[model samples]
Target: MAAAPSGPVGPNPPVIAVVGPTGSGKSDLAVHLALELDGEVINADAMQFYRGMDIGTAKISVAERRGVPHHLLDTMDVTEEASVSAFQADCRAAIRDIHSRGKRAILAGGSGLYVRAALDVLEFPGTDPAVRERLEREHAQAGLRPLQERLRSVDPVSADRLGDARRVIRALEVFELTGRPFSSFMPSREYFQPAVQIGLDVDRDVLRDRLAGRVHRMVDAGLLAEVARLDAAGLRRGKTASRALGYAQFLKVLDGESDTASAAEETIVATRQFARRQLTWFRADPRIHWLDWQDPDLVAKAAGICASPASVI
Candidate 1:
């Protein structure tokens, strides 16, 4: 755990990080917690940043939010790229504003990388445009694996912090510019403001059931129509926005490559796999207080943890 700076801020209530696998009801918990604590939620999901990506990303609707304030969701369109550094910067600023206003800030989502980056994955280098262009070209030609391997060699430290996609791009950039892995510049660890983290989870059977039910509801909610709309807008297959679960599968269906049942099947399988990956990423951090989905007082427990004295945060 990183030490809190010795200052007046030490006595303040901790910022809360709500994390968990998909289909875990994390967003519901966040809204209720925010209401309880006079807090506002800041999105930590990478996918939820884009506008018109509501259904696929499972973004909270205004009605679902129950009048609680939220931030960072729908802050960008699919055409624009969002990154961890930009998220980190925006989140830090938001946290500060919340503190100043005497309100709690809740960071919520299943994207472990975004949450971790906002919390402590600091001292990592920012992107360089020229290097990014060159590396992007390389990635376009030779593929991401080679770039990832290059990252593993030069900047294993930084590479280890990034997921495969980010690692590959950044490593290639570093290699192109400096003939080295981008890892050398990374410090062992960097500090962040004190924060309480809670990860929500359910029994495997329960989780799968919830996921399947959600997929069925999405089908009813015109998820296929939504995908067709995106396609009509020219967001084609290979673009990041089009790669979201259900979208790609539906697009294939739209393109006559598969049928509705096949698309739904593929989407459901992919969503479950994504949930598993989310679980794997977060389980590494022992700092996150794990709460069972059935825990009746889960919100209270999380609030208690946020206010505890032993919190290294």
Candidate 2:
């Protein structure tokens, strides 16, 4: 049996994970669950970790958090690399701390790997700066196509999964360092702790409309201005932060390659694609209990999952 973070207790409450696509109301659900269960939230969204990335990431505002304590948001500088390995350690520690205080730990976000790293028996491969630098140099000199081809030849699974050049390079670096395919390091379906995952489901057509409206709302909420501020703060120097959906599109605007309207449309399209990918990732995990995003009694249903010992463990 899993022990509560406080110590060896009679029965340890399970950690709750709120997961779904980008515009699927996971944040609101997480807050509701936290309030209902006396829980704290640990962020699994990799982008939300950057201190100044608020509006575009749809980070829950202080007022929206509903008096529930949240951990791991705004934890990194715009120029720092977000590491899954580091997040795993920090998340486990946060869960333990919340448990010590006799509150449940709610892990919330759409980031699949980050969530898995936190709650599953996943081990990250070691990184070598020399290898990474070589891959970076190759990418800079030869572009993504050549490196992507190399990754395709070596790790076809990762090649199919990774669309961005940075990830492709990273996968190649891992293969070079370990003499093993990057996919070989993928974790089996085993929980690192007693946990329950609640995934939000939505119809694809409705989700597309919702995502488009959300992108428009974000733009109206000053997403361009937010990107401007981060750009000034050396956002381009950050390997991970620079590639965030909204941020990347707007950066093209700043570079005179796109306009605000076009960037908004591009972001919407990219987000829709990303949402599909997120669904693919979470749906593959048979462990997640899916709930419809539009359910009228959403909070109560999720709360039931938290309260039921059989459903949780």
Full-model lDDT for every candidate: 0.76, 0.89
Q: What's model 1's lDDT at 103?
A: 77
Model 2: residues with Cα > 4 Å off, grouped in runs: 1-12, 152-154
After superposing candidate 1 on the true structure, give the runs of residues whose Cα lies further than 4 Å from its correct spot.
1-12, 142-167, 177-180, 183-191, 237-239
**Alpha-carbon TM-score of each model against the true structure:** 0.86, 0.93
lDDT of 1: 0.76
Clash totals for all models, in order?
Answer: 3, 0
Cα lDDT tens digits for candidate 1, 68-136: 888898887665666777888898888888777777788998877678777774645656797788777
Q: Judge candidate 2 against the unseen true structure and give its global Cα lDDT, from 0 to 1.
A: 0.89
- TM-score of candidate 1 to 2 decimals: 0.86
Tell me how many residue pairs clash in candidate 1. Answer: 3
- Would you list the clashing residue pairs of candidate 2? none
